[model samples]
Target: MTTAPPVHRSHTAGNPDLLPLLGRTPLARIQADLPHPHPGFWAKLECLSAGGMKARAAMSMLSGARRRGELRPGAPVVESTSGTMGIGLAFAGQALGHPVILVGDCELEPSMRQLLRTYGARLELVDRPAPRGGWQAARIARLREVLARTDDAYWPDQYNNPDNPAGYLSLAAELIGRLDHLDVLVCSVGTGGHSAGLVGPLRRRWPRLKVIGVDSVGSAIFGQPARPRLMRGLGSSIHPRNVRHEAFDEVHWVGAAEAVDACRRLARSSFVSGGWSTGAVALVSAWAAGAAPGAVVATVFPDGPHRYLGTVYDDDFCRAHGLTATAPATRPLEIPHPRAAEASGWTRCRTVVDPLAAPRGEAPAPHIPAPGGAV
Candidate 1:
């Protein structure tokens, strides 16, 4: 066992001193009374790390920046995040002797704001998202403004940076070491870091692996029009470039109520997975296990329940959001493309991207009738 470092230390992922705190989270097997037979579900308990999987990416990004001489000694680390990655960066900054600044919109939960501040990160809040870019864009513009003011600030743009996904190479290796063979890999897509990071290397090792992406109903990552994302860390109003669209075989969009049900049931039956993305991933993983006979579905549970006690676990809060449910509002809305014309459950698209929009826009693919023309 490695010695526990203090909250404040001087190290990054590249430093031999900090490697022990970042990756190699435990992989736990979970069984749900859904479907399928043996070779049950396995999930990497990412909360075991200091700040979960995001810390690993933060370490990797900062370390790379240090090596490239992008980060000055004792410079402030500034970036935009909803909560998860923001806390991760704050933890990283504390360890590496750098001040951290996290920029986000008001929707950032109070618990996260306090946690980041407790870790010694400066918090910057943007009033709203820009007309074109949305919340993420507003955060980015705020980051740029901060960067312009502080020349020493190092921004690890998680959305577009290659190093963000590169950080999870160790996580991928750890999963490979634990699992004998992985058939279905279910993961949530936000900045698309973990899914792209883990699936890329795993696919090379397990040639027949089916990568199933779990996204929020409103997220544009799968090419749907931007909508309000009730769930955090899983959905995106703007399609992130980090999402390797080619890496996925099929995608499932889960809603808030379905996620709440999944989280509560998993906590009681299998693992206490917190966070919106983990619930979505767990729901899809259970479905995948039932869909494929004798398949071992590996998923990533990125966090624990403490952060969600006031919301996902709070009955009153759930009632406010109309998330109180013993069953799912929608079972998995499988779509061929993110912007497909219609789908009740399963769908497939020949051309997933729009030629005019090219990247973000979704061209229509005929399937079911747009979920009663809702899409």
Candidate 2:
């Protein structure tokens, strides 16, 4: 007997699925175990995206660019990322039948690397810079080199590109339609794209709304001296031009332990497994929800925790980093201390601090040598 002709999968199934395989993540009215005044606050579950948080917005931006003639058909796309954005670009490029080249620093997680390959992106690993110098300089240098040598390659420079923030603007618009009024929007800052992009549109619609920027303690973005940080996906050693400081009403500096604890709390209570940055945003949101009492707070859960299974979620790793227990719960409301004012560059609200809070001003000073030849 002749065997039936072999069945074939859809042509589209060869690549990592894009919009068709993705759906809008639910915006839940968090009530269980969360302290909030308006009965509940909305939590945008971004982890439900096909490639999680980054893929959802990245695909939208790339697709929009293609439709708007911003990108040539079949042009290869190149980007530098520590993780999430690269994964998103990989998936988006695959869906559009374009090749992707991802330049990543050595700090990239193994899972993220595997995901990029699975989505058919070529990964180029760059060496980590010297201690105290960090990877930003090295990563940018490598990206520039790759872009110069590659032909017909588009650099979706997420850090500086207007489209980066524009992508999040779409997300904010979707959120506004679901919630009647949002008192505050909390998000963790890396390139500051998400917060900067969302704040512009949301503020135009709701002038009274507050945008809170959460940053990891060692990140230079909020003005700390350049240093290694345990937290990933939030906080940067270099200033990203796209960060619109004026759009933020307040900023909070969180330590790694606090972020990890918050992540665990979210998992236990909401069944939401989130990355370190998401946990930091969630912690800030919970604090704001408690402090404001009658106000509605909304926050973005950037990505799922699976990519960080070897670090943030591992008890041994947490202990090794000296982040073994939960941090004390504190309200988000702030009464500025004199020391904080003296140390922080910009002073506005009691809770407001300069995004670049180190002795340096909001903008990064040119990498200059000090009198004694020190940085």
Per-residue CA lDDT of candidate 1, range 304-366, in tens?
887888878889999987666334443344444455544332233333342235553335544
Model 2 misplaced stretches (Cα beyond 4 Å): 1-17, 31-40, 60-70, 130-133, 325-375
Number of the top candidate by lDDT?
Answer: 1
Q: Single out the weakest 10-residue window by summed lDDT for candidate 1.
A: 1-10
Candidate 1: C-alpha lDDT: 0.74
Each model's TM-score, in the order given?
A: 0.86, 0.81
On residues 137-241, what C-alpha lDDT tens digit does candidate 2 reach at each position? 677787787777766667777877777777676578778888888899988888877787788788888899988888776667655556677677888888887
Over the full model, what C-alpha lDDT does candidate 2 score relative to the true structure?
A: 0.69
Compared with the true structure, model 2 gives a TM-score of: 0.81
